[model samples]
Structure formats: C-alpha cells, structure tokens
Target: MKIPKIDKTILVHLALFAVALIYGANYTIAKEVMPLYISPSATILMRVLGAAILFWILVGKKRLILSNKREKIILLLSAIFGVVVNQLLFFEGLARTTPINAALIMTTTPLLVLMVSAITGGEKFTFFKIIGISLGLLGAAMLIGSKTVSDSSLPFSFVFDFNLGDLLILLNAVSYAIYLVIAKPLLKKYSALSISKWMFTLALPFVLPFGFSDLGTTNFEQIPTEIYVGLGYIVLFTTFLTYLLNAWALKSVSSSVVGIYIYLQPVLATFIAVALDKDSLTPTKLIWAACIFLGVFLVSRK
Candidate 1:
C-alpha cells in the first residue's frame, strides 16, 4: 500500500486559494481587532514577531544562510516593502477605514505589479494595460466618496472626499507590489520559509520603533476573546500561512498569476462581511466590484 502523489499544479492552486481565503476573511477579522483591542502598530509588531518565530522553528537555520551581499540587500529591501511598510500601512489604514474600501483598493495590485514590472524592464506596457489602470483608479476614487465613519447612512455616496486610511492602503498596495517584483528572484533561489523568516527578522528594527509604545499599552487580559482570535488569525494564517503559500505558488507560476488571485479577496471579503454583519453590499459596491474585476482581468490577460 502507498500514498498517491498530488499534482504540483493542483497544490499551487490550493495554496493560492488558501491565501485568498485567509486574506479575504482577514479584511474584516483584522479590522475588528485594531485600534480597539490593540493599536494597529502594536498588532503589526505582534504579527511580524510571531510569524518570525514560527518560521524559524519550522524552517531551521540550514536554509537561512545567504551566499552573497546582493541577497542580503534584497532581503533587507524586501523586509522593508514586504513586511514593514506593507504591514504597517495596511493595518494602520484598516484601523480607520472600512473593510470594503480596503478590499476594493487592493484590487489594483495586479495592475500595479504590471506597471512596476514594466518600469523595471521585466515586462512591456500596452494601451490595454493603461485602460485597466485607469478603470481601477476610477473605482477606487468612487469608493472613497465623502463618507466618514460617522456617516453610516450614506453607504454608497459618490461625492469626492479623502479618507486617510484608504490612501494608506493604496500606498500599502504599492509597497507590496514593489516587494513582489523585488522578491521574485529570491523566491526562486531560496525556500519560501527561509526567505519569510529572514524578511520578518530584518523587519523587526524598523517595525519596533512605531509599534513599541503601543505594545506596552495593550492590556491583553482586559481584551475580549474574539479580538484575541482575530489577532491570532492575523499572526498565524494571514501572515505566516499566506506568505508561505504565496512563495510556494510563486515557485510554480508567474508572479502575474499570483497577483491575479488578489481579485478573489474582495469577493470573499464582501461575502464574509455581509454574512457576519460587519459590512453590507450596496449597488455601488457591486458596480465597483465589477469594474475592478474587469480591470484586473485586462491587466492579467495575455
């Protein structure tokens, strides 16, 4: 008797699906814990530190060694874009903005990745890509209308306004896009666990300064159990599992395929949010979702 072997392509798709599922649910789960049970920055600190320890324990020291200065530099920069700026801005932004907005804005990542790759000479630009980018930006702007946290009644307004959190999430998308491009070569050379652990370890110094004070302020005992559960999800599933899965998938597929999966988050997030009563779906949200999906489809199209 013997166990049957699984297909690598199936495994990659499963990994990507798991990543999208974790992240889509994370939009609301993480939002529930931040700026209330714990500050956003402190949450980042916890997430990075916890994932780093887990990666180290899981991967061991053998794969952690680097062969060259260039790899070290790339890891450092990846830590900045991938861990520090990416996590910091996203958590902080989610603390202040709606989960739906975060989900919608994040649909731009595949387009951003394409643009970054083109600028870096890794890919060529085309008119269709330009149109896709424009559509994504338009959808984002529509979602950011003059609706404040207090203005819950105006769920789908189209008036122009700025939400700092939405803007930060946008920047987070850009940072993550840069990380994807910079870390592609590294992923091919190193085990995903090894790269992930090192990136989180290097991200510590930069993350600590921002999150340190908030870390001390969180009274863990007083927080509710659900918040802790949310925290654990962010630390374990969203941070560790998702990164490992993405890195594994990257080894088997193009980064563009990886980026395309981001479109799943909004759809999944919306369902989770609506089901949990954490958020609602409106006509405008549906319309924008369609626009975003179309844009991402064009960007990922050959």
Candidate 2:
C-alpha cells in the first residue's frame, strides 16, 4: 500500500485550530474548578504530570530513548519555557484577568513568535510580516477598547488598574516563542514524542514544590468532584492531546503557519464562554475576531 502525500501545512494549522477549540472549553471549565480545588501552581503541576504520563504511555519504552546530551538539554529548556514558566504565567494571568482579556491577549502569540523567529534567524524578516503583526495588534486593541467602553457593568477603575493578567499572558507568549525556537534544533535529533516526554519530565520537578504546597492548604475531602473532572479534561485534552497534535503539525509545517492558528483561539474562547459560562457575545468581539483572522491570513499567505 502506498500513502498519499500529506499537506503538512494544512494539517498543522487544522491541528492548532482544533487545540484552540479544546482550549476554549478549558477557559470556562478551568476558571471554575482551579480556584476551588487548587492554586495556580498546583493546577499547572498536575497538568504537567498528567500530560507526561500520557506521553510516556503513547511513546512506550523502546522509542522513548534520548539520543544525545544536546537533545536532553534542549528538552530541559523546552520544558522550562513551554511547560513550567509558560503555564505558571498563564494560570496566574487567568486568575488575575477576565477570560476575555486573557483570550484577547493570547492572540498575540503568533506575532510574537514571528518576531522572535525573525530575530533569531529562524525566519527572514519581511515588510508584509510587520504589517500583519501591526494589524493583529490593532485587532487586540480594538477588542479590549471596545469591551471596556461598551460594558457599563465593568468598573471604570479596572481600565486604570495595572492588568497583571495581561502582562502574564504576554510573558507566556514570549516564553512559548523561545520554546519553539529551542525545539526546532532538537526536533532534528529526536522524535516529537520523545522531546515532549523529556520536557514534561523535566518540568515535573519544577511543578512539585507548588503542587505540594497547594495540597497542604486544601482539604482533600472538601474539594468538589467537578474539580477533578475538569483537571482530568485539561490534562488529557488540552495538555496531552493538544501537544501531540501540535508537535505532529510542527514536524510537517513551517513555524509561521503553525503560529497563525493561535489567532483562532480567542474567537473559539469567546464563543465557548458565551455558550457555557453565560458570557455575552458582543459586537466588539466579532469585529476583533475579523481583524485578527484577516491579519493572520495576510501574514501566513505564501
């Protein structure tokens, strides 16, 4: 039997969008459950552990081997940026800001990734890319500005309050971009699953301190069952499955294409929030969504 040539570009983008959809559900679910069961650090710890376990199971023993010291170091660095720091910032940011704000801020990840890539010589700098990034930034500004202006219930003070959440999300984007840059070198040495597994393993130690502390503060018996269920979903779908798909996509496509898929996340998050959390679907969100998608399309076009 012969296998047909797969369009890796399409596959990567689609996988990323699918991950965004899963993550959309997570924003509502995680927010509700995370505060009830555990602190942000603990939540991240469990997620990393669960994702690692799943990756181990998928890869099995024979294929799990690391080829060299460089591979090991790369994996460690990837874990530091992608899992440990990125997730810590993201959860903390989520705790600080509205989910809508978090979502809107996350749309900037691709632009940041492109910039980082260009700076590092992973990708060439181009005038079109700059325009695309500007459009994305404008979209984000429009989204946030419109939201603040239209929602009378929102405290005017919030606009002035330094948004630590937005800052954390921005930090996550930078950390994730760094991880992507580091991973590119290691991907040549190891399979994506191997790299992912090692990264998770390294991240596990970093997460343990927070997990144990959070456990000490919370009463195990008093925690609601829904929290466990939500945690499980985040571990299985968002962390494990999403990473696998993302790695597969990255193997096949250019980083720019992979980055474009991030723009879809906020749109998916907004819709999911409306359907599940009783959040309003505003005209501002619609307009911002259009801007973001159009900008991403322009940037990603060949």
Q: Model 2 TM-score?
A: 0.85
**Per-residue alpha-carbon lDDT of model 2 for 88-187, expressed as tens digits?**
9888878766666677777777777878888887777577877888887777665544443435674331133356666787788778877777787666
Which residue segments of model 1 deviate by more than 4 Å?
1-3, 145-157
- Which residue segments of model 2 deviate by more than 4 Å? 1-14, 63-69, 138-160, 281-294
Cα displacement (angstroms), candidate 1, residue 214, comes to 0.8
Model 2 misses residue 219 by how many Å?
2.1
Q: Can you write out model 1's per-residue Cα lDDT over 36-106, one digit (the tens) per residue? A: 78999899999999999998899887657788999989999999999999999999889888888899889
Q: Which 10-residue window of candidate 1 scores lowest in summed lDDT? A: 142-151
Please list the C-alpha lDDT of all candidates, in the order they appear.
0.87, 0.75
